[model samples]
Target: MNQLQNQVSPYLLQHKDNPVHWLPWGNEALDLAIRLDKPIILSIGYAACHWCHVMEHESFENQQVADLMNEHFVCIKVDREERPDIDHIYMDALHQMGVSGGWPLNVFLMPDQKPFYGGTYFPKSNWLQLLNSIQSAFQNHKDELQQSADGFAANLEDKSIGLYPVELNELTPIIPEVLAKISKYLDPIFGGIQKAPKFPLPSLTLFIESFPEKLDTNFDVYIHSERQLEKMAQGGIYDQVGGGFSRYSVDSEWFCPHFEKMLYDNAQLVYVYSKAFQRTSNPLFEEVVNSTIHFLNRELRDSSGLYFASLDADSEGIEGQFYVWEFEELNSIIPYEKHAPFYQAFQIKRNGNWEENKNILFKNHSVLNVVYEKELQTLATVRAKRIRPQTDTKLLLAWNAMLGSGLVQASKGLNNHKFLENAIALEESMIGFWDIKNNLLLHQISYSNQPIYAFLDDYGSYGLFLIHLYNETAKVIYLEKLRKIVNGVYQNHDQMNYLFSFQSNLNAALISNKYEITDSVIPASNSMLCELFFWSGILLNDVTYTLRAKDMLAAVLEQAAANPLYHANWLRVYSEWMENPQALVKYNPSNYAKNELPQLRVTWVPIVDQSHAFLLCIGDRCLSPCESIDELLNQYNSI
Candidate 1:
């Protein structure tokens, strides 16, 4: 074992026994690079990435390749989940280098940590050739390489420097046009954008569902939402036996998945499907929501109620080994009487849909008619005997917060008290990490019980979770906690207009301060913060939070205008900003069931307060106080 044996990150630990001397990204590695005047081979990936595993086996574990890497460069490995701040910096560098970014990110940087060349996975021979070439270039042409690195670093810094200030007036008129452009990519049949690899772009779907008024008359957002939800639920990307969704589908049909389950993805998905269930009263959506929550509670949850980061795709060193099954194996496991229905329901074929006669179970027929719970249980029981995939046990604050918030939303939509109970438990557990004196949260609790400083996403999502809890329970303490977190986040920023992805003190080793604007697999932290600001402003009647939200939206208006889908979360914030008559309803706790408010079905009604009477407000204007639920509903409808 090397230096990585001392690290807490699961991804780093996976490489602890590798021949390559892998150092975790920190001052030691950086200092070594500087002292030796050696270029750095920085590799970034997560535990769940299949290609990352493949690359590790192909080149990193190979003795010849390890010797070359050790002799020529200072090699650093980063777990993207644990250190997304580092990933963002280098991924942005790769994009700036005009390369499309993906997992197993291999970038060769100068001793100063400026990336001059990079690419994704390469075969062993190619990797060896590239290493030799890079070493040669560093030795023979130092000046040219330094000039290129300097130019790249300068360009990267430039992206963060200038901003064209946008006013609220300029943002309103562009909404309709932005929505129209976004709709052009929507797949009428399969529901996501017409693309080969389909992701359940939750923010995009949420934005589409949130603002139906902005969509063209020809486009029905519900149809798109329903189709997408149904397809994903029936797809192999979803664990039909187990609950929760895989990362993304490799094919447009959603039948082939990458097979890693992430906390953030499932959390966002739970929110998405729950909203769909509420809007359409679809049983399928309700089932997906329930099963997903079950999966989280069963598979991902720690004893303290915090969710783990992810479940790896590969088990026993083979991709999809744990998930797929052979036709003969299934027949032998399941009884003869139940075999036909089971095979037919899951689209299990003798020929197999995946590699080496192994099938990835998907609903080829109508999902509505199928009820294979017994069969699924049988399969699950049998599969449990096999070696399970490695679970990345680190508890991430932002991801757990997302899941907690999602549980609250799901509970409301499904009217399931158990979900709400789980949410409350999760919230309680997450609160333990809060440093009340410092007014900040720890980013994650490692398996070894080490605490890392919180990043922007941790503050944004956790703060939002607190706000959600406040709305649900009408507890003033959560609101107070949110206020402190908000204050702490703003204290680090030079300007309150936009928040950076990493906190100021936490980002000492980063090449540049990054403001994450575009939504990737999860919603952007800046966008989540904008949502937090808008809601908190109205709930607390604070103008500063509201005004700052508008300014932050304005700051990203140009980017939102350019690629609205990439900035889908920003559009959700913009939609909330533009669409007014946001009903802030206050009611007496004695008059109604505080926990079970059917009125929450209305997404616009964000704030709920317990008082002697019910009052509805739209921005400063207030309706006359009502005494009962009926009167409150009538007043809300009239506006």
Candidate 2:
């Protein structure tokens, strides 16, 4: 009687055998809770989330705990990825309750699905205590909780409705100032935007693409940003031993990382570094880019071609156990002659780098100055033997799309065919497995043969990826696929004005649902959809997509134009359209001469269909696509 057997989310299926009569988040679960007059215990998590798995194994699977849950409460399970709207609402409630929200989020809701209390995780004893207390409150103080639920629901509905205004045209002009504020938020010493426990800031990185023109020649802001990036690249947050980056740094100095390796972070960072390489021609940026891609190829990618989601932050139930090492271990690995200088330079004391006896990682910035010295190579060789952390092998569509775009960027900037080849391979993998039919992409693919339907973000992101890759490779297959997916998204989600809604057909089954619009780590799907439409129109030489793109852009134009600084996504679209509002088609990537000319601002639409592999040069007067890569190079050289 495992209710989750019919569910698609792997996270939900992990609790299938629990004695608790777990219901998937739907109208049925809400209706049951209302009918039974019981509090709803809603648990939210994703499959790749380690803590989510840990909580599942510890409590959700325990028969006694399950029995308690089944008898006293109506338990429900939700996958955060499958339905971000539900997760967002509950997470907001948790935040409002003054708790920092995280995966394995457990919320106590009234029969009406209004969350009254939520905490990330609790041990068995604490969980039991809370459950007992909650049951008591629900039974004895029922009217108070009911009143609170009513209030909560009204406030939540109002919040969701207020998030997306009907007219946003007034806000676009101020985008520059908000973007500057974002830049100001960057830690000059450390790499990330904020303080400790920093996220990779992929959203910010994408936003950086629009700022080069605004920056000065010395690019002080740009230099500061690059310096922060370099600090991070050299720091332990980036796997110095491995090629990929971890989830984020625990401390602001980028000294200690959480140790989880995410495919999305690396992919996005790679794209950022590649652009940095092109912008500055910095050798350090190039090295980081190469090393990152090396890590992606070596560990994260599956044989079938799609990239995995993330590596766990902890292994064998001990956080940082796999990645950390003792000083003796490093000493044993290093030769006698090289040990002293290496140890001193890295701040490696006899005790250790992190928790006294255990080594985290340390990099001497001075090493860059002396990297050519003979001692450096010998030290690097010895340091490679430590045990690395395990990787999460779940392939995610959104992540793969990010990687695809990264490869295209790397290829464009580095002129590396290998990068292009890897991009193609990964894209092929996504198309092969996630394409479902000729129309849609799936969200996740696991080894257990379970195929989950993609969410709004996945489809939007994947579509963006296809378009970017087509721009790079100009492969017909990619463009055609891009066309299909874009049209598919419009078919699947568009109600009227082309403002993309996150809720899909599957979400209609939910008893009480709400629409929301706050771009989380990634930009909103509708924002991405608009960008895709603009680029698609320019690349395909189609006016219909262009008109749609105009409407989409106009929809947000006023807000974006008025306050474009805060709206990074809108600024990015503006950057693309800046050259010629009407003559966007004149900036096609397939034009060889036009494509090769560096120093000109570059914006590419994904060209999927196999068009001529030449570069199109957009000058003051004419248009002709160069026939060959060398020809394009020759034109740039002449210029």
Candidate 3:
């Protein structure tokens, strides 16, 4: 057994019995590399990555390749989900070396842990050649390799300030430009980033929701946003039989998805779909929301209600084996009377709609245009009997928070109070991750029951989600969590202007501390913090937090205008700010009708002071207190 045999990360455990001498990323591995004076093989990936599995089988599991690796390098295996900060740093180093980044990220670093060279997955022969070459280069060309490592190391800070922003552009002017810039990239017909291997980027939908300034008759932003959601819901990327979404579609038209299901992707998608349902009253979006929630609850969630990280892309050693179906299987599953239309709606070809005689269930038409829930459910039952994909059971703080906040939105949008209860309960369960005795919140709770130090996202994202919950429930518990998280973030704030480093006080500096500015699959920690502080300010009636939020947003806004896709979350907060949203507060908790308040229209910040009426205010700008919930809604609607 290798060092990974004792690790809690499922990704690490998967490779535990491999022939390669795999060491989980830590000081032990680093110290070993230095002692042996060997270049470190830093292989970073997660459990759900299909390519990672392929590489493991082809190279790490092969005795010959493992022998060469053991002879030449100290191989450190890092589960990216467990140490995203480490992944972020090394990936940035790879990018700096003029390499496009993906996982299984195999980077060769000097004994000092400076990355000199790297690439994605390599076949056994190529992996052997690379290992032998890197070793030879290390012995013969030590100075040059160290030089390359130094150059890459110097450039790995993420220049996050410049990349993300310090927001200088006025909200009014940039709002139109941000919309126009993002609109140019929209696949008008397909809906999402205009590219193949398309991800369900929540930023695009959330940005549209934030600022819906239509370009022209040729392009309506709202319709384009809805089309993307509808197309995704109707496509294979979404599990037609099951209720969750896969990581991404491998095609331009949302068909044939890369099958891993991520907690973050599904969580963000729920929030976006729920918001769309509120805006358009689209039942299809509502259906997607409810089903995805059901899927997460059933599959991704633990018995404790905390969601696991992701479901692997493969089952029984074949990609999409668990999700895809043979054409005949579909034919036999559908009712005899409904066979023809079900086949037509799902694009089920006799041979296959996709690879190797297997069909990924899909519809060419919009979800709203078709009704096939009955047929899909039948397929789901049959699919359940197949060997399931291995689940990565790492519970991440930000991810749970993302889903919890989405549920809060869905409950308000769909008026499902049961969803609300679950959201609250999920957060309540997360209390275990918080160390009340030490006042240290953790990013993950391991199998050994040790608490890992919180990252900025763990602090910021969960804090932001808690703030959202407080808005919905007016509960003190969420706010109390927010207080701990806010202090943790501030403790780690250091001196990086308005931005916070990705590492918390407990997280040691890697080669460098990553400051997330650009929003990717999830909002950057700084961006979420901007929103967190803004809402926290309103909720606590603290002016300092409001200023901190404004400062951070202003800085990010400067860099966001040029590339809105990268900084969509920043712009979303800025747009929400422009709306001058009032905190519809009531002095009496009994006066606040949970369902009566229009959630999307008004940002609720509950304060049960001694006042008699509902007070609505945008910072200092205040509307007269209203006597009834009806009166408050009337005043809110007028705005």
Candidate 4:
């Protein structure tokens, strides 16, 4: 029987039938281990992780492993996604233990539920040996094991939970300084930040774009940002042969990719690229955004407009197999007439662009840039014929909401009606389909299917998305949905005095009493929640939500004040809060329904209640209800 018989997470349910009598992490499991005086074996992984699947098949499925686990220790299974707080605590433990960590994280905890030993996946033979060795140590060196566990527990307790804040004034000047410093770090001959194994730092690129707004309008800053953006747009990091970006390049020149593609990266990159196009009027940047959109539509997005998580780095048991091309293969596939144009567009050479005569994808002597419109169209058609990698179809709520927000932003920036439409459709899917009758979000939805219950981050992000979608379309329904969800989140998750936990039920896994501000694969749930309260207050004319927003910020203000640069998300929130807030309220939803508004250069913030009064410095501006839609629009735009 699997350890996850009655568990909530689908990932945990997958291991229920494994030979190991794996116990889900809980009080009962911990209590049993404590009573038996046995070490706890905690195995952590996610549902879609490929290597996690491999380890299960190789070692966890074995009867010998199960027998050893049952007899020698308490075995526990943890789904990293379902319980990130638990994952964070253990990951920190592994770091302190001087061991590298990855999924499935194999950690041996003491009876008290503190990790004393851990490593990632080990071969089945090696794993069996390890089990025997650990069993021996606990039996023969019981005192030694107790001492180590006690020391580890003490060290963990000593680690501080206090937050530090970075000052906004200090950050106001640092953007230019960082831009200059970053310009020096850029590979001049090739585009990208520094040397090989180039991860696309979309954040850095966007920072460079915003540098001028934060600093002096020096031409150097302008020119440097443009050059960096242009070079990367044309290079292999951009998927010159295909249409979308790989995760990163293995080299500084944006050549030789790591080859995985993530929906979050593409969504953020599209917003950045589209904005760059607007700022510089660079056709190449425009092309990059357009191609990336095509890639998302073709592979990433479900029918509802929510995007899937990722495409694997490997295909057919080999890394980059689906993406890499050979000279002979290219020649064999293309006719003589089209071959020259194709070669020029992709920067292909007879010697090949990568190691061992394979094209890692970069232009050489022939292709200066993808200058012609016809050329790009032709390449897109040809590239579509190639074998594509399988995509991970699990629809994560936070990520989907992020893509929804990004697509809506991009649509506004590019004046693309389809992108806006896609955003609306996605919002409907999340609100109408994913929400269980229990008034909570489902975290993962199958591709082209209905969603499951949502995570803490889901409601927070979706709430924010609803607000943004309202800004885009000026639909009352969007705002109304946002209000309902925000109220639901506050009532369901909030504790007294500005605290919120991840789980709706107090009996569910205890995540945290305080906010976690760290930006990981997704922006922090706490940060998004803070934003929802702040904005909802402005749009609705409610003071309670606004005050609650301040309380949440104040709770962590000290931490953010101490480390402003590292707390980018907090700083972003602070910047808006401190600035003269501009509120745009349109009463006539119909006017905005068909109109294509020029993209606002400012970060468009949609606030409802009385929160806008303080930010806009328009105290009690309009107490009387406006008689007409035009009057409301005018009053809203005045701020």
Candidate 5:
């Protein structure tokens, strides 16, 4: 075993047995690179990446390849989940080189840790040839390589100099143009954007939810949203027997998936489905929400009441082995009477839809029409006997907070108190991460038992969830915590207006700090921070917080206006900013009946206080306080 054997990350532990002498990314690796006069080979991947596994098996495990790597380089393995700060810097470097980046990121860095060259995955022959070439170039043309490295490092530094505040322009007209651009990419047949490998970009789904009127009237957004949700519900991307979605579909039809389930994806998806149900009152959306919640509760949640990071895509050395099934195996497990309905509903065929005569169960029919629950149970029972995929047990604060927020949204939309109870419990559990003395929120908790200082996402996402909890329970404590955390975010940043991806002091080894503007698989941390600041400003009556949010929004508005799909989260913030009239519902607990609290269809700022009345407010203006819930609803509707 190498240095990885002692590491806490499951991804690094996976490489412990490989023939390659791997070192975890740290001072030891850097020192070795300098002392031995070798370029550092930095490989970044997570436990759930399929291509990561493929490259590991092809190159890292081979003896000859290992010998070459050990001789020529200080090979460092970085689990991207564990140290996203490192991954972000190198991935940015790849983009600077005009290379499209993906997982299994391989970058060659100088001893001083400046990245010079990188690419994603490579075949064994190609990888071997590339290694020799890099080695030869490093030995023969040291001056040229150093010049290239210096230039790349300079570019990264230039990009890191903070965003400047632009004047806020009318974003209302740009909304229609953004929607028109989004409409051009929509697959009229399949639902999502017209792309081959379809990902459930929750940001897009969220944009649909927030801008219902704009999309529904002009773009048929409601119809398209339903189609997309239905396609995912019936597709193999969503586990038919089990109860969650995979990372994405490898095909445009959502027929075949990469088959890794991530907490962040499911959490945001639950919020999306819940909102869809709220809009349409569709039973299908409700079903998806409930099933997804069940999956999270059963598989991801630990005894600590926090959710795990993700489940691996492979099981027992074969990708999708645990999830996929042979037609004959299904035929034997399912009873005769149930066979035909199950087969017809799930598109089971003799030829098989996937590789090695295996079928990834799916239904092309309407999700509402499908009724094969009993058959699914039988299949699930049999599949349980097989090896299950490994779960990455690390608890990330941002992801857990996301799940908590989703549960709260689901609870409100579906009127299911159980989901609300779960969200509250998760909030209570996460309180341990709060450092009252230092005013810090730890990013993650792992087996190592060390406190990883929080990143921007940790503060933004968890802070947003705290706001949700405050709305649900009317608890002042949640609001107080939200304010404190948001304050910490500002304190950690050099500029008070915008947030950086990592805390300023954390990840000091990184070449530059990154500002996440575009939404990725998860919404940008900065966007979430902006929303938190905006809401906190209103709830606390703080002008500074409000102005900071507006400044950050103004800086990103031009970028968002140009390509709204990528900046969906930013657009959501802009939407709320433009439509500044927010309803503030103030209610007294003693006067109003517990069941009489208004069920909100539109977003509102709910406050619980000692006053025995309800006050409706739009911005700073307020209507006279009313005694009855019905009176409050009536006044709100009139506006």
Candidate 6:
């Protein structure tokens, strides 16, 4: 019987009726592997992964392949979104085997749960051969395989902290040097790195925006960052008719995306674009922000104010089916008069701008003013009639918190209090998922049931969001909530070498207490923890928090300097640390004007002090309170 029938994860459910008897990852499956004396086929993938669906259709659903798999292995299906801990463990194991990591990651693990061999996405023919070969190896050379697994298991101990040794960071001006190194990879003509299959890693642009007041010896990082943002805003990766961005482009030109829309990516991109708008007053940035927010509201949001995980990359058994458009489809929808400009602007080709004789809408950055606003709405109205991509209904706390954080930041950029209000509403909803006394957080908000515990990223991200809220609202309650989360991370998580832990659960997995030191598509949980500690330390007036936060950044500074793209989040924190971020204790709610200052140095610590004065503080030290906002601004500018 397929044990996955009971699972809430869409990915697991996708395989529930498969000919292979797939069990959700649990002790039952592991014990079955041991009892049957069989190797474990641990398949990990997320709901929205196009290849995951492909593999399911090609192999798992094939009765012949299923017979081979069922006879040899106790197959365990894990939705990476539902069980990131298990995913991280096996994915790391795959990496330790010197394989580049991706989904759907298929690993052959021992009954003891240590991964011996792994590879991603195999054809049915290869998979069949692999199953027989692996089964033969297990029967004949069990001892040798165990030893190899042991070696890989030992190397898994080198998770983040052990792999990247904690150095005695100089706390000197490393930003200039790091920026110089990063400048080498920046695709100046287009926005992102000079590599194909580009991701809109907001961290890179965000880091460029984090230049201190004094780091102006050379390099206009803003221009390069702006160019990238503008390119993305005008690219196919960003949905032109609809709102929100796809996962990433499959090309350097941002012409074709992988087309999975993750809540985290959209959330992070919104925050990045808002900052861009704040700095440059670019209407495109504002429009993108507004449109993306609308996308989130209309599609992703549950009436409860939390969001769903992602939109699947595949629709109707075809990737990009929902998002891409045919040439004639555009011709029929657009008016005859506007067809020329619309086709010219969107670069729609009769043979398709993308695969399958369809166009992925995008405009050349030079011709962004070629108007098609009314035509886009018409297209959206028509496109709305097609079958939509499946939404992964799992409402992750980390993702929701990120969107909340983005909304707060957006409120600043758009000069609209509505964003902040929306953020507050989201908090009201998400706060229900937390068990503050036990330091317990549900992995995702669910209308029915939430069986998973929140991971380290969830805690760190929620804490970071609370920090943003506290600053924006001057609500001491947000800081108090942040303190609880910080305490939870400190007490609940087992430390990895000298750095922070990767997840909230201590006993969930078999091996590796990893530290997420570098940034990926989303900022690492530890980087968020660093921010959490930095602010909680500053605002809460705790020296322990400050020192711990500083140590976290210290551990990654050298590595972060070496490769800033993967460590851009850490670089942002390091840059802020070097600047000695000052907190301004304002007696009123922080408006957009105060927060959006160019090269702003002070962090807002809002309080309803009876005397409407501004208190400037650095670490624990504070200057005399200023009499007025003007005086504070003047004083801050001079300093």
lDDT of 1 by residue, 1-639 (tens): 257998888899999999998998878889999999999999999999999999999999999999999999999998888888888888888998899899999999999999899999989999999999999999999899999998888776535521776777644566677777887998887778899788888998887776654353545556777788888888899999888899999999889899999999999999888877877798888888988888988899888878888999999998888999998888888854666876787788888988899999898654652377777888889888889999998889899998988998898789888888898888889866766666556777653334457888888899899888777777778878888778768765434335554544544546766777788678888888888888878778698988878788878878787899888888777766654434466655555556545444343233345454677776446679777677778877786
Off by over 4 Å in 1: 158-162, 170-173, 212-218, 335-338, 368-370, 435-439, 447-451, 494-501, 507-509, 588-612, 619-621, 624-634
Residues 95-170, model 3: lDDT tens digits: 8878898999999999998999999999988988988899999999999999989988888865547445443433
lDDT of 4: 0.65
Instruction: Give per-residue CA lDDT, model 5, range 333-417, as digits (tens).
Output: 8854557877877888777888989999888877552367777878878888999999988788899999999999999889899
Q: Which of 1 and 3 is the better model by lDDT?
A: 3
Model 1: lDDT equals 0.81
> What TM-score against the true fold does each predicted structure earn?
0.94, 0.82, 0.95, 0.77, 0.95, 0.94
Show pairs that collide, candidate 5: none
lDDT of each: 0.81, 0.67, 0.82, 0.65, 0.82, 0.81
Candidate 6 regions exceeding 4 Å error are: 159-170, 335-338, 366-370, 435-439, 446-450, 579-601, 608-612, 618-621
Clashes of each: 0, 48, 8, 35, 0, 0
Error of 2 at 161 (Å): 5.8
Q: Which 10 consecutive residues of model 4 have the lowest summed lDDT?
A: 611-620
Tell me the spans in candidate 5 whose CA falls farther than 4 Å from its real position.
Answer: 158-166, 169-172, 212-215, 335-338, 368-370, 435-439, 447-450, 496-501, 580-584, 609-612, 619-631
Clashes of 2: 48
What's every prediction's RMSD, in angstroms? 2.5, 5.0, 2.5, 5.6, 2.3, 2.8
Model 2 ranges off by over 4 Å: 1-37, 47-67, 82-85, 96-98, 123-125, 154-176, 217-219, 366-391, 433-439, 446-452, 494-498, 506-508, 511-517, 547-567, 578-639
Query: Model 3: clashing residue pairs?
Result: 165-555, 166-554, 166-555, 167-554, 167-555, 167-556, 167-557, 167-558
